[model samples]
Target: MPQKMVEKIEEIAEGSDDGLCDVIFHLKSQDLTLTHVVNAGGVAFRNRSLVTSATELLPPSLEVLRERQPRTIRRKTDRDAEEPSFASTIARAPISASPLEETIARNYDRLATAIASAALRPSVERVKDRTKDRFRQYRPAVLWSSESLRVALRRDDLLDLRQRTDFLASLNDVYPNQQVGVPRYFSPARSSAKVQGELSRVAWGVERVGAPAAWGAFGHRGAGVRVAVLDTGVDASHPDLKGKIKGWAEFDGSGAQLPRSRPHDTDRHGTHVCGTIAGGGHSGQFVGVAPEAEIYAGLVLNGRKGGTVAQILAGLDWAIEQRVHVINLSLGGRTLERVVRSPFHRSLFHAASIGISVVAAAGNDGSQTSGTPGNDFFALAVGAVDVKDRCAGFSGGGTHLITESEHIGPKLLPLAYSKPDLCAPGVDIRSTVPKEAWGFLSGTSMATPHVAGAVALLRSACQGFSDLPGFRQSSVIQDIILATTFDLGERGLDHRFGFGRVDALRAIDAASGWVTDTSEYRDRRNRSPVAPPSARGRLGRLPGIGPADPGA
Candidate 1:
C-alpha cells in the first residue's frame, strides 16, 4: 500500500523482465498471483499472466533458486520439476501465541520489509544524516596562526566556523619551532669509506655497544625492528632513506605538501628528531640511534608547527594500524586529560596497550605543567638534562596539582617535575633536518627521542623479546635503562637528575649483566691494594644488578 513498497516491487520486476519478484507481497485479502513478461534488451513485451489465485497461493510466491538453475526461467515446468520445488516447501506457519508475541513478530516482519525496500531503492539521505552526526560529535579543535587562518578562510567560504581558518587562528598558538635543522658536521656527500670508518669508531653508549658489535646476536641486522616517527612527513625519495623508510599516511587535507613533495622545514624540529632516532649514514656524515632499524615517518604537524587535534589523532591511528614497535612523539601540550576519556589520549593508550612503546617530550614551557601526550601514563615522558648531568633550566618541575573533581595526589608532573627520570646530552646535540639542511636547537623535544632510539637498540638486541608472551608484562626495559645511568647531579634520585645521566655503553653492559667492581682491602703487612672486581657478579649478585630487579 505504501508508495515506496510499490516502487521497490516495480524495480525488482524490471530487473527480472517482469518475472515474479524475489519478495512476496501479502494484502488483507490474502490473494496472490504470478505474472511473467518477456523482453529483448531495449525491445519490451506486454505483461502475460502465468497464474492467478483468488486465495493465498499454495507456495506463497516467495521462491529461492537452486544453485544450478538459471536465474530466469520461461516455462513453469522447468521450475516446478527442479529439486525441492517451492510448492512443497512450508515456511513460517502462523503460530497461536500470546498477543504480545504476535505483535512483535508482525513488527519484525514489517521492519524487514522496510529495510529491504530502502536498500534496494539506494537512498543517500540516511548516509548524509550519519555523516552530519559524526561531524557534530567529533568536530576537532583547530589551532593555527593568523596567516594560516587567512589563507584557509580565503580558500573556502562555505566551511563552518569550526572548520574555518579564522576560528582556528584565534585559538592558542602554543607550539612553535616547526623546522628541521642540519648539524654543522653533516655533508650531503661523504665517502662511503669514511662513513663506515666513523660507524666503527663511534663511541656508542654502553647500551648500544652490543647489537652493532655482534653479527646475528639476535636477528639479522634490520630484520624485524620497526620504528615509527610521528612528526613532520619524511622525504620518501631521499637517497639515504629510499627503501628503508616504510609506510606513510597524510591527515592534512590541504594540497600543500604531498608524499612526493618534501616540505621545507620551518623549524627543523621533526627532521632533528627523525635523524636522532634513525638517520641513515650518508657518506661519512651523521648517523642515527638505530642506524639499521626500519623507519616509518608520519607527518602530523604542518610546516608551521601547528595542527588540529583531529590531524594528530589521525596520525596516531595510522601509526597503530601499521603495528610499529616504537613510536616517538617529540612534541607536547599542556592538558590533564585522561586517555580513557579523551579520544586522542585513548588512541595513544591503545597503541601502548598492544606492546608499542610511546615516548614523548616533557615540554619546553619551563613550568610544572606536563603536556598532553606526555602526561599519558602509557607514554615514557622524557625531560631535558644539560651536559653537566643537571636538570636543564628550561625543564618543567613536578609538584602536587589538582585535576578535575578528583583530588589526584602527588606525581611527577612532566615538565615541572623536580627531578627528571633520567638525563641525556640535550644541549648542542646534533641530528637531521629537511632540504639536506641541518642545525642544532635546544629543548626537551631534542631529548625525548634519544630514549626512543635507545629503546630501538634494546629491541634489536633482544630479538623476538617483544614477540614473546608477557615480555613487556614487567618493567624490564625501563629498569635496565635507569640502573645503567651514571650518577651526575646532587645525589641518588635527586630532583635535578632523577637517577643519573644516560650511559649507553653502561646500559649495554648492564643488559649483558656484566660489571667491574673496585674495592680496597688492608693486607697482613699493613699494606693495602685496590683490586677491582672483574666485569662479573660480586657479593652473590650480578655487577649491573640494582636494589630492584631490572627484569622484574
Candidate 2:
C-alpha cells in the first residue's frame, strides 16, 4: 500500500458513517479456502454467519470459472513487424466438459463446511499462526467469487484495515466494490419517457442496422444462439417476450442466488434491453434483432444504489453455466482509471477466453468519459447513434490507456485504444416495458442490445463452422463488427464512434465469407492498418485489432 493512498482511505473514512464497506481481495492462489485465509489473518473481514446466509450459492473454482488469459495487442516497435496480432496470439483453451451446474453441486458441501467452520472461534493452532487478531472487531460478511481466486466482503473497519501493514500485504490487490447503474442522459424526460400506445411498426434502430437484411440472407433469426441479459430483470409475460425467455435467476442484496426466483423487473430498463435483443412481434411489429434467440435473464441490479459488484459477478457465473453465446450488459460505472483491476473486468476476460461475446454500454457521460467493463479491453463497448447515424452527445467515448495492473499484466508499454467499439441506434428507441406494456428509451443502454443481438445473429449464422471459432471469439467478433461498420465519426476509428456505427448485414456477410483458417484471419488482420475497405470491397481485406491509427 502506498502512503498517499493510505492517507486517502483514512481521509474518506473520516466523514463516513460506520456502515459496512465492500472490499475485494485478489488472492495469489486459487487453492486457499475461506478457513485457510481467515486463519492465516489474510482477510480483514471477520466471519459473521448470522449476517451471511447459509443458503448462499457456492461460486465455482478458477479452474471452472476462468480459461487462460487471452493475448493482448501491444504497441508496434521498429523490430516487431513480425509480431503476431493479439486477436489470435494464443490458442483458446478447451472449455471444461463438466457443466457449471454439476461443478456448483460438487463444491457446495466443501464451501459450506469451510464457511461454517471459519465462523467459529479460531483454534489454538490457527491462532498461533498470526501475531494477533487485528480484524476481529470487524464482523464483515464475506462472499467468495465464482472464480474462487478472489474474495469480496463487506467490512465496517475499512479505515483501520488499510493502516495495518500485515493485513494489506496478505493480498495481491484490493478494490472497493461500488454500485453501478444504467447510463444516465441529460434529458431524462425524453430518454425514459413511456410512450402512450404501442407502435405497431419496426423500430428505426432495427431498420437502420440492416438486421432485416441479415435475417433475409441467412434465414436464421439467431435460432441456435443463446444470450444472457444481466440487469434489473425482465418482464417475462410481455407480449413480445412471451416465448423468448429460457432461464431466469436473481441475486439478493447480499449476492446470494435466491432459489425459485421468478422473472420480474424492479425497473423497466432490463425489460427494454431484453426486448431489443430478442423481442418477437407485438402489435404486428418486430422489435428484436435476434427474435428467435434464447434469452437468459439474470437480475443483478434492483433499481437502487445499493446493488453491489458482487451480484454482477454471481450473475456472470450463472450465465457461463447456461453456455450463452452472447452476454448483454446494459449497465456500467463511469471511471477514468487506466488499468483494469476490478473483479467484473476479470470475469469479462474469462468470458471472452471461453468464446462468449460480451456487449457493454459506453456510459452516457459524453466525450472523454470512460466506463468500466465497457471500456475494458475484454468487452465490445457500444455507443449510441441517432436515426441519421450521428453519434449521440451523451455517448461515452475516448482513447483509453491500457496500463499494467496486477490482474491484467506487466506490459512493456501502455497501449491506447479508442472506445465504444461501435454504435447503434439509441435515440427514441421503442421497446417493451413492465406490466406488459411498451415504451421508448434512449442512451447507450439502448444501443448495447442492438450489438449484442447482432452477435447472436452472427453466432447463429456461423453455426457448425469449426474453424472460425474466431467468428465466435470476442476479439475476432469485435474486429469483424468494427470492420463492417458504416463509418459515422471520422475517417477511421475515432473516440466518438469507434470504428463506426455497427452494420449487421455487412458483419454477417464478412463472417460468412471469411477464410476458414482462423490463424490466417488473425494474420491478415494484423497486416491491415485500416478496417478492410468496407463490405463493398474484397472480403479478404478484413480488419485486425491493433492500436488506433496515428493519423485517425
Candidate with best lDDT? 2
Residues 1-552, candidate 2: write the lDDT tens digits: 456446644554554454444444443323322222112111101111111211111111113223334232243442111212123232222222233355455444443443344322232223223324633322222333233222222233455556556444444455555566645633234532222232235566776676665665566788978899999999999989998899899986545688988999888889999999998665456678888999999998887553667677778878876778889988888776655444565466556545688899888888988677788756788999876677889898787664543332343235456677678888888788888777788889999999998888887887533333422255456546666677665765577886677777767666664534344333333232123334223222212211121111
Q: Could you tell me the TM-score of candidate 2?
A: 0.73
10 residues in a row with least lDDT, candidate 2: 42-51
Q: Please give the clash total of every predicted structure, in order.
A: 33, 0
Which residue runs does candidate 2 get wrong by more than 4 Å? 1-16, 29-85, 91-167, 185-200, 304-306, 337-341, 407-411, 464-472, 515-552
Backbone steric clashes in candidate 1, count: 33
lDDT of each: 0.41, 0.61
* Model 1 lDDT on a 0 to 1 scale: 0.41
